[model samples]
Every structure is written in C-alpha cells, then in structure tokens.
Target: MPADLSHIRQVMEEADCLYSEAEVEAAIAQVGERITAEMAESNPVVFCVLNGGLIFAGKLLTHLRFPLEASYLHATRYRNETRGGDLFWKAKPEISFIDRDVLIIDDILDEGHTLSAIMDFCRHAGARSVRTAVLIDKAHDRKASPDLKADFVGMSCIDRFIFGYGMDYKGYWRNAPGIYAVKGL
Candidate 1:
C-alpha cells in the first residue's frame, strides 16, 4: 500500500530531527577519513546498496579523495513495509568482484541481515576484501546477525522507526535534508 502524501508531510513536520545536515556531513567526512586511510590504496570497488544508500553514498563519495569505482546493488528486506522481512535481490553490480576490495555502503544497520547477506555475496563472488559502511546504526541488541557490524558508522541512534537522508517512510521523505525519527515511534 502507498503512503498518504498528506500523512508523510505531516510526519515530516512533526518528527524529531535527529541530526542536522551539517552534522551528517561531518560524520560522513569522518567516515571518509577512515575509508581513505585504510582502503584508498587498495582501489576498492564501492557498492552503494541501492535506493536507501544512494544519498549517503553520493555525499560520502564526494569526500573520498581516492581512485575507487562506484557501482550499486539493489537488495531490500523492507519493500515499502514498516517492518523488515525476507531479503530480495533486485540487482547486482555488473563488475566482477574477483580479487577486488569491495566496500559496501548502506543507509542504516537495523538488524544486520541485509548487510550480512551482502558481505557473504561479495565473498562468494571472490572479493579480496569486503567492508561495510552505514549512515546510521540502529542501537538494538536483537540483531539478526549478532557478530556482524559495519566497518564505518556515521551515527548511532536508539531503535526507532526512522526516515530521511536516503531512508524513506513508505517510500517518501528520503530527500529530507537531515536524519529524523518518526514521531511517536
């Protein structure tokens, strides 16, 4: 089902702003620093997990002063639903991962299922190394994969239904300038 535009707009108006644009940029800069320091020399193939990761990857890529090729893969556990379910692979990168250092960028780390599967996929594709990055790390103890974690994390937040900054509420609000948690969530 599609979200009501009016409700989305109303939620945006009332939702709590978690991080401002400047702060998000600063966090991305810090993440970029770590990526540059560790993976720049490896010429990694950066994979932006599609839809949600687009904005974060686009912004973060600008600060990465390295020679890395950018591509994207489409995978989703939450396809327009508030709660996550099964993983679906919509698309994969055209470039081969063989012997390549793969960097996976995502919008958020909620349960770690998608990221973990992506990491496994990259490894199965023969990637030399696989590292994950996310704009937000949802602070929850009940992760789907407990041992997995992002190599680079921009921000951490209490578990809540969140939107904005490449994350959407019913497929809207992704273009909001800052991170926001849905009101009453």
Candidate 2:
C-alpha cells in the first residue's frame, strides 16, 4: 500500500537528503567537468527528453561547454504505474543530425525500453553516434534487449521508485528539495 500522510510525515521527520543542497551543487559542478572532459571536442547532438528530464538537462547544459546541437523527443510509457510500463513516442525533433554525434539527456533510466528505443530512432534518423546522459540510473531488473544504454550516467539507483531532483511521484513531488524513497518501501 502507498504510504499514508502520517507515515510520510514520520519519514520526513527523520528524512535525510541523499544529496544535500550543497551536494547537488557540487554534483552539478562535477557534471560540467565530466561532460567537458568527455565530449567537448565531439560536436555532439544533445537531446533532452521532455517533462521529467527538463530540470536535469538544464543543469547539465551549464557545464557542457562544447560545440553541440540540441534537440528533443517526447516519449513516455507511464499513465499511473510506479514501475515502468510499455513504450510510447512522439514526433522527433526536426534538426539535421546526419553523421553527427548525438547525446540524450533523460531524468531516469529504469527498464531502459524507452531510452533504448530513443537511441535506435536517433540512429535511424541518421545520427553518427548517440550517447545518453541521465540524472539517475535505475538499474533494476534490466535485461539486455537493444543496443542502447546511457554512455554517461550521473547517478546510480537500485530498484525502488523515488522522487525528487527532477523525479516525480504521480507528478507531485518533482519540486521537492531532496530525493525521496517511497515511505515504508
């Protein structure tokens, strides 16, 4: 069962931020350092997955000082499920990407289906290389299916559904200060 407000309040009482405010700032700084060191000279194509990845992608861009193109694709598989569901896609961005390096920024990588599909689509759309960047890597029950995984990972997660740092629970807690594990979970 989902945790009640009382339980949530209890957890909040002793709640510890997995990434404190300063930690988040420091991490963002590190992200800039890593991205610049890894892909500065590649002239990559940056793709930010819509809605959830918005916050993380924005912050990441601050550190990515390179010759790159930015685009986005809208794909989601969630309506009301906690765990990942199926797959969905929208119209791809209309930016020329033939033989160009592409980087995808996403909020989370759970089952990897949606992201894997995105990478495949980008390749088909004529991207030379498609790398991925995600704020959180939810590597739970992952099965090798397609030739798509984030070449760049910001954080690692086990399997539990979480919210915060741009992640949302039923579209509610995305703005929460600290990332939160579901209470009693």
> Which candidate should be chosen as best, given lDDT against the real structure?
1
Worst 10 residues of 1 by lDDT: 76-85
lDDT tens digits, residues 1-185, model 1? 77688988999999999999899899999999998999879989999998899999999999888899999999877788877777778997888889999999999998888788888889998999999999999998978777868999999998889998899987898999889989999
* Cα lDDT listed for each candidate: 0.90, 0.73
Best by TM-score: 1
Cα lDDT of model 2 overall? 0.73
Clashing pairs in 2: none
Off by over 4 Å in 2: 1-16, 78-87, 143-148
TM-score, every prediction: 0.93, 0.81
Question: Can you tell me which runs of candidate 1 are displaced by over 4 Å?
Answer: 77-87
